[model samples]
Target: MDFLLEIIMTPAILACLKIAVIILLFAMPLGTLLTLMERKWSAMIQDRVGPNRANIGKFTGNGLLHIAADGLKSIFKEDTIPKGANGFLYLIAPFFGLIAAVAIFAIIPIAGPIGNFTFQVTDVNPGLLFIFAITSLNVYGAVLAGTSSNSKFALLGGTRASAQMISYEVFMGLALMGIFMVYGTTRVSGIVNGQNEYWFGNLVPMWGIFTQPLGFILFFTALVAETKRAPFDAPEGESEIVAGYFLEYSGMRWSAFMLAEYVSLVGVAALMTTLFFGGYHVPWLHLWENAPQWIVTILQILKFTFFTVVFCWFQIQLRWTVPKFRFDQTMGLGWKKLLPLSLVNIIVTALVILTLA
Candidate 1:
């Protein structure tokens, strides 16, 4: 019994619990809130009222109640499987997307060390590679959903999704090669720590953005495409393919797809934070090296949260402001434009690093 208790109380077990709680309580709710925000933001852009109907005794909470109403509606709605659909894959595909999106957060550090614990799920060494591998699995969710639905539109959406994701992923990986080469390590936390350094008598940040400006642009663009958002959203082009790969889905299963999209939005923001914007490092934060650890930790968390929220808003803004690219235009940009530019960025970064060394 003592041995059992000890095992249950181990640090690894506690960390696992912490991670699970963070995902459920923090990440999940944030994704849901983002869905609401997307509606509100788009409404603001298009001059329309957004989600003001759901209420209790004239207390709608300024559209916030819609989130709860949406959740309840999905839960109570009919979950339909098409007569010709492969029921097994249709049921499981949403889980694949959600899991793939949420898993990326495991390796992402939210803040620096606090006592004997760190604010992350696990500190994997090949952190960037791990991210790429897990995110690539998300394509399978789209592919499976399309194939299993047994509809031409769904299949076309899935095929486009797979092709588009595969194309951008090549550049996404190459876009970060400059970061890995400059930082000299693939560990996420290590990259964050490296960004804490100062340059020119503590005037400028040694952040990824400073060293790899072009790379940041490429990575951010590729990331937006990877998340299947506006401008790069040809795969799910409503005008062309109806609702795309998720056309047959309804109820909670459909909600699962939306949740996955928003979660991937958050994950991409976090990755951008960790890679380019200095993670949890406050600008010139090292000046207060002797500050209390807990205070510093809280400040770091706040900074990271602020940046993530801003990026989320930015993505939502893009969705409303920009027009979706034509499928051919999307393919051409990814393959002919972004791909070549990323390759050039890598070579240029290498030469700069070698010369400076």
Candidate 2:
């Protein structure tokens, strides 16, 4: 009983609980719903009915049952290993992406500090670098799956993924130079809190979107491509390379890859919210200085959730709306265009900050 109380009452334990709540209860569920959301959204964009077929007897819940149906199918379906595959690497490849996707939320907070506790699992100093490092690990899943599968299509897909990650990752890091300059810290919480300040006599919040618009665009684009979504999806070219590196996977292994994709989709949105939007901050909440802490905390969580959903919706819409770029075009955009612009953005931002200082 005493140990249980320690587990329940310790501040560190509470922080862990918050992290679990955010990732398990929030991020995972949202990712699951987004799978349905993307299909439904694409159908709407294409002027057709969305998924409404998966039903439990009389209740389909407007295609919500598809989530369960998919889960069961992945579980009950036979797991297969291709001939000539590296058995150990092939079995473990799917988890690399999943691990990376879930790890990102550890440093992400859903709200401001509440009394003696914070709404995050860990508060390391070099948080943004941690994010970059974790994100870069996602490529391993593709590379391993492709190499181990022993298929020409998967091999080609893995090659594309490696090149794509290498190109975009450069500009992705370059793009953040401006934000790091503006905030003067690599800590994500610091950056989020820095945005809470208002400028022009409190008329506007100094959001990253306003200060580093180009960086936001570059970062988000790189992140999308990193997830191997459409438009930048040459790595998973279902038509061109037969589901890319994940083509040979079946049963829960295939499901794991898909889950990683959706979770990363959510991660992208969460990163955007943290770095650009006011990150769990309700704008002008300072006006209500007398509000209860519980109320304020609730409001912050709601604000974060709202923006996250909107961004998810936007990404889904973007995938359906934009045409897929050929592999070369995708590479060209990252190296030829975004890289140069990101360099320019960094130089100009530094000069501006120096002059202002």
Candidate 3:
């Protein structure tokens, strides 16, 4: 019993718990609220009321309570598994979905140094590889959920998902190669540190977005595809595929898949924040060289917060602005367009770096 306690309560375990809680607390509510916000934003864009009907007993029209109501409503709804579905796989699909979504958080650099310590989890040297590896896991969840359902629509969705993920991942990794070459490091924290160097004069800190604009654009596009959202969301097309992979799931299981999608949204936002937007580094961070630890911590948090909000807003805007692409168009854009461009971008970046040196 004592041994079990010691193992379970280790510093690593505690750290994992804190990270999980931080991610979950931010992710779950943010996702649910964003669902409402999307609707509200869409309504304002088109001129209509959205989700104002949800309320507590007395507190009517309070947008805050709608999140709780919608969640509870989803919780108590019917739990149904299709008659022909593989019961065990069907049961596990949502778990896989949520797991893939949440796992990416492990590699994201949330903030700058807190005194001598960094405001992240393990800052593994192979952080770029880690992102690629975990992102590959996401397709499995989609494929399994679709295949195990024994439904035609689900199968089509799964096929699209698998192909789409594979096609886009190529460019996603290649796009990062530019940044990797620029920094000569795979660690995300290290990449941010590389950006700490000043360019030109005292102004213009060297961010990857400025140095590798083409790579950043390709990375951002591929990330959009990888998240299986927006213009790339043909798999979940209600007009044609009928809710895609989750067609066989209902109740909490369905909710898990929904939650996973939003978590993935947040994960992509965080990744974009870390890779391109400078993680938690405020402009002229080096200028605060002598600031106290608490002050530095606050600054880091504020930076992260600003970027987080911006990323969320950008995602919401994307959802509204971009129309869904046809399946073939998606494949073409990924392979014929982005993939080759990313490779060329890499070659050009490498040659420039070599020539300049």
- Give candidate 2 regions above 4 Å deviation: 1-5, 9-12
Q: What digit string (tens of lDDT, one per residue) describes model 1 on residues 256-335?
A: 99999999999998889889999999987778769888888889999998998888998899888899999899999999
Model 3: worst 10 consecutive residues (lDDT sum): 113-122
Residue-wise C-alpha lDDT for candidate 3, range 234-315, written one tens digit per residue: 7787779998887778878888888888788888878887788777777786775688767777887778767876887788
Residue 218 lDDT (model 1)? 97
Worst window of 10 by summed lDDT in candidate 2 = 114-123
How do these models rank on lDDT, best leading?
2, 1, 3
Supply candidate 2's per-residue lDDT for 267. Answer: 90
Please give the RMSD of candidate 2 to the true structure: 1.4
Query: Could you tell me how far off, in angstroms, the CA of residue 206 lies in candidate 2 after the best superposition?
Result: 0.5
Which portions of model 1 show Cα errors greater than 4 Å?
Answer: 1-9
